[model samples]
Target: MALRGTNQEFGRPYNRRIVLESIRLHGPIARGDIARRVGLTVQTVSTIVRELEEHGYVLSVREEPRGRGLPPATLRINPEGGYAVGIHITPLGIDAALTNLSGDVIESAHREAPNATPDLAFDLIGAMVNDLTGLRPGGRVLGIGMALPGPFGVESMSFVGPTTMTGWKDVSLRERLAASTGLPAFFETDMAAAAMGERLYGLGTGYSEYYYLYFGVGLGGVMVHDGSALRGAWGNAGEIGHIPVVPGGEACPCGNRGCLERYLSLEARGRWSGSDADWVAEIGPVFRNAIAVVENLFDPETVILGGLASTDLLERLAGSATQLPNSVSARRDRASPRIIVGRGGQYAVLRGAAALAVSGVLSPRFGQMFTAERERGRDLLQGKGMAA
Candidate 1:
């Protein structure tokens, strides 16, 4: 949904996020334009902009008058206004990045912890957090965000399979990471986090609605609507990896035969023992089926494929995905490609992990006011979320 602001004084925080988002998306724009875009009065926009300027979050770009009375000053987000740390935990390693307000990575660190236990991962994460923080002289470190393999909180599907890390079934990542780093922590499934990162800082920008197909250790996807994730009831809505694609095909860890990931994931690619072209050809039908499923079910503006793989590999998949079966996205008036390779290279999830922290402080949510006071101390936003 398009962001709108309330005039109610109690909605100040919400309005503040709206104003900031306006500037982030459409700035260096005039105060008048922000007011019109967010449905706030010019007076309220002025007030919010002034407060943001005072807080060093918004920067005035042009103040010189053109002709008439004081020309409206265009505003933009201050790149140095804040910073956040992002951590991506995979079976192979943990990738960490420290990002500025504009999603630029200031510093990064990677440590391998193959099949890492929770304790070992936490220790490495703590060291990385310290290393990243030490590199920065001065800035507001908003918090930390983590992206992990998904199917979270389920007895059968969470943190137990070959694709996921073991000894983490009972670990409360948010609380433990927060206590360890002394900064509030947030987390999401790798797929959703990649989608969020793509939406905010990569090719998914300007496309309000899209489906992100994440090719990680396993296959996964996320649905974004109006610039927010449509996280389902249990927060594992996009576990497309486990969906049955082939009847009586390969047996998957999640107790399914012919799961999509069995034929379409990195694990599957690893098992191929063939060239990239051969792998692409092998999975072409399954990839097209997955795209058709995404298109028919979600009808997203576009489907973005990305993750811990090479750009060349993702490009190959994108090329194969174009000759798809009849789906809702097959339109003669299409303005964009049906499927495209994502940006940010392999750091998409890492950037998304950082975005979780940035979004918590700056992005507006629907029920934030009611929960803000209660959740202030916790700062535990999780999963594929709508807030960013």
Candidate 2:
């Protein structure tokens, strides 16, 4: 299978991204070291470095020579090189942030938007965008990345459903947000956005594949493979909220009985008054089964627990979880545990939303990686005088 990647182009752009990635991942590094690491000739690396410097994606700082020669120059990502606006529109409200090229949060704002009309929602987001971008003197906001509860635009789905945000049934979020904010918009399911957030800013940077279990007021997940979210048909791949964990438990808007979210989510728990012990016992089986299902289906290297729900609730769940059923991730010699607990909670999703924007501008996507490969193949053929 073609390795899933993104946002890279053939030739100079591809090389440029590599150089930037090196600086981003291990910054304040010298050009010669970068050339050695990325496997490029010194001259080629120098040319790309010069371009990066001219465009402001990198800043050069002088490094002391190890022993004798003149001090070397080091390159690091320029915090002001680029900017992106990340908006997380949840059932409760809109959370937004301005992130620099390095995925650092420069500024942030939040506005509650329960059942907010389209005009009101866009107005709030627009004002925040203006305020955020205003912080960066002359720096342009490249685009806006948004994450909201999903099954986006699905016909016959009721907006009044508990899992869905009200007043969003008739609105086209992408179009409205772009038009209102006057910037291009990218959209994702909240869980998907959380996964992207982790990938760019949290646990995801180290592992290429993992499952993100987001504990929004309800439960959901995002399957990330090789750093890109696995978008199922209709971009609703990780709608695990409706996964049937309770069989005959609770009536769900998705027309299922006993969805796992009913048992595991804070909203559902808030509806009852059982003791924590009794409650934990009731919820334990479902989470156990759900974790097993994730292992079997995704075979992720790690599973991260995140989202904007009760930390005590999630911590209890994570603490009580048992050894996973035999799956790809379960192994004896693994350096890190199969499961990772995320403490960022609500902020993680918001930061991840920002990461989506950062990713679009910074990450090397599969399309470009493939395009670069194709060009190389063409060059090989042309060198042999095989094809015009």
Candidate 3:
């Protein structure tokens, strides 16, 4: 009946995960720092560190001198601990990559997803994982993170929204992948993954609160607050595509009139412009209008324009947004939030999935299991018997 299940059974694993996550996020971090950051006592942090070091999931580096006191030893994640596979399932193809703890892509493979069905997609993904895992540096893969078109529910394995692909709705994607590949799997909306990618490795870094405006086949926004993606009640937060931008412009599939996606999305532009360049020119104003709406409502630190929208297009849109009327007249002196292009481009979603997978492995909730596994492996190598 418990949401997270029994604490007695999950406590150690949870703590270990937290410790590993702390190290991954702020590595070359001292034990004291990990303790402070993870909200655990020094003794608990020391215990976790010992476990990680024994397992080879983490390694202690040479002490760095700070003052007259003894130099503090730093800890870092071991890239060899495990590997994660990230797959971006776009309308065109399945772009996949294998990455380690450091987010370095070791290998990549792509296959067209043209008219892809759930069975065919899962089979291809399984084969891709097999091929990539065969070439892994240590021949061991931890898990897989899949990036799919929006409205994904891992519990139900249902995908809602406008997807050209079939057999996707209500498909237990994670279960199928796990069964086919024999590894744990995680699923995330492509836009949400892209947002995570930006936070970890792209422009969204440093800012704790921001919005990633994904403008691809459709338009959506990913909201981040205090370094975590804000999934509102029912996990439907940041559904900006449905936000009303035009009262009678165009009808949307979501049973709405003149939705933001109808104006700002590439699919909408395709009806207006025959090519990508033409779409960029025509959609800039619409994109600017959407930005103005977001700025006026959320007033985020920055609005990251991404999806398939080009950098030049985003810049022009940013310039145009400055001309829109502001309702908050009292805050006229406040500088408007900057609108910038996402750095990952077409691969942003996949990159974000990989990053998310890596984070899961290094997260404090799962760190202990990894640490225990690593320590067991290390003990075997050292000819020291591990605890049963």
Candidate 4:
């Protein structure tokens, strides 16, 4: 129906944000309709629309006949007026993408991860951004959103396991990256970024709640509820890769035996190097078990298979996961299958990273703004947002 938590009492900034979001989501729609739907007064919507149009954020594309009155103008987001960058750091490599306000990829680049020491990686990132920006000068850039593999911000470097970026302990990513690139940067777990990407442009277009199983050099996952990630209290919500699947089977760097990824991840298969038939055999039971837990735990619309893993391989994994336990999502007339293989493929996390950048420009994050205000609004306060 109407948008969430919107009330007559909310101020101009809030109303303007809702107007902007409405135009982005449901435009070339009339301002009159936006006013009716978001419960804002016609004068308020008209003023917000005028402000947005003057700022190059919204454009009056066309007009619709209104029977006995002047035709109403239809407005939509101006794709070229703003741009965003998404960067995904993986054990295998780093991927970066530049996208317009509409989330369309304008350009992309990739570099091998082994070359990415703290200094080198920063330089590479700066160079990549320069290349993308230079392609078409004069486009306004929103900022960069970075997706990194975690257990992030831990003090003592782990002797072994997934938290293995060398020379990175105590090197604050947001602080360092911002200083190096001279752009506001936001960081998130790769899987969570992928989930947000899907939320904006992929499977999340249809499903509100789903599980993203990201198969990379390592395995990770994120559960999406509503349109945002379910970031736990400390922001370390999704780490399903370390879940013990083959109990007492293999030693894991996360200090567990038989972690699910140990048996079913692509890296594990690569290290072992078996035939596809042998590979299928090795991954089946663990995948089935992981599905059982994932399906039962969240009762999401489906389990999305995504990340750096190839679609052919993900299909095999999805095929092998046939024995899903009974759940609320398994009802008759179910629109979604138990498993959905992602189409974004390798760029899923990168696209997700881009989505975060777009969100910073379009969505209202009062919670984040207030928290940054406590810090005197340094890098986090990209005042460029809320306006666009």
Predicted model with the maximum TM-score = 1
Question: Over the stretch 247-365, how does candidate 2's per-residue lDDT look in tens digits?
Answer: 58888776778878877776677776996667777777777778888988887787888887667766777777765567766777787776777655566666677666565555545
The TM-scores of all predictions, comma-separated, are 0.88, 0.80, 0.83, 0.87
Q: Using lDDT, give the best candidate's number.
A: 1
Candidate 3: tens digits of C-alpha lDDT, residues 219-302 = 778888887788777665777887777778787766668878777766676567365566656666666667667777777777
Candidate 1 vs 2: which has more lDDT: 1
Root mean square deviation (Cα) for candidate 3: 5.0
Error at 9, model 3, angstroms:
5.9
Residue runs of model 3 more than 4 Å from their true location after superposition: 1-11, 39-44, 63-70, 153-166, 274-278, 319-322, 327-337, 365-388
- The alpha-carbon lDDT assigned to residue 45 of candidate 1 equals 91
Writing each residue's lDDT as its tens digit, candidate 1 over 165-188 gives 766898988888987788867889
Candidate 3 contains a number of clashing pairs equal to: 11
Q: What would the TM-score be for candidate 4 when compared with the true structure?
A: 0.87
- Candidate 1, which segments miss by more than 4 Å at Cα? 1-15, 35-48, 63-70, 364-388
lDDT: worst 10-residue window of model 2: 379-388
Taking the tens digit of each residue's C-alpha lDDT, what string does model 4 give over 71-99? 76789999986888888876566788998
Steric collisions counted per model: 0, 7, 11, 0
Instruction: Give, for candidate 4, the lowest lDDT window spanning 10 residues.
Output: 379-388
After superposing candidate 2 on the true structure, give the runs of residues whose Cα lies further than 4 Å from its correct spot.
Answer: 1-45, 70-74, 156-160, 274-278, 322-330, 362-388
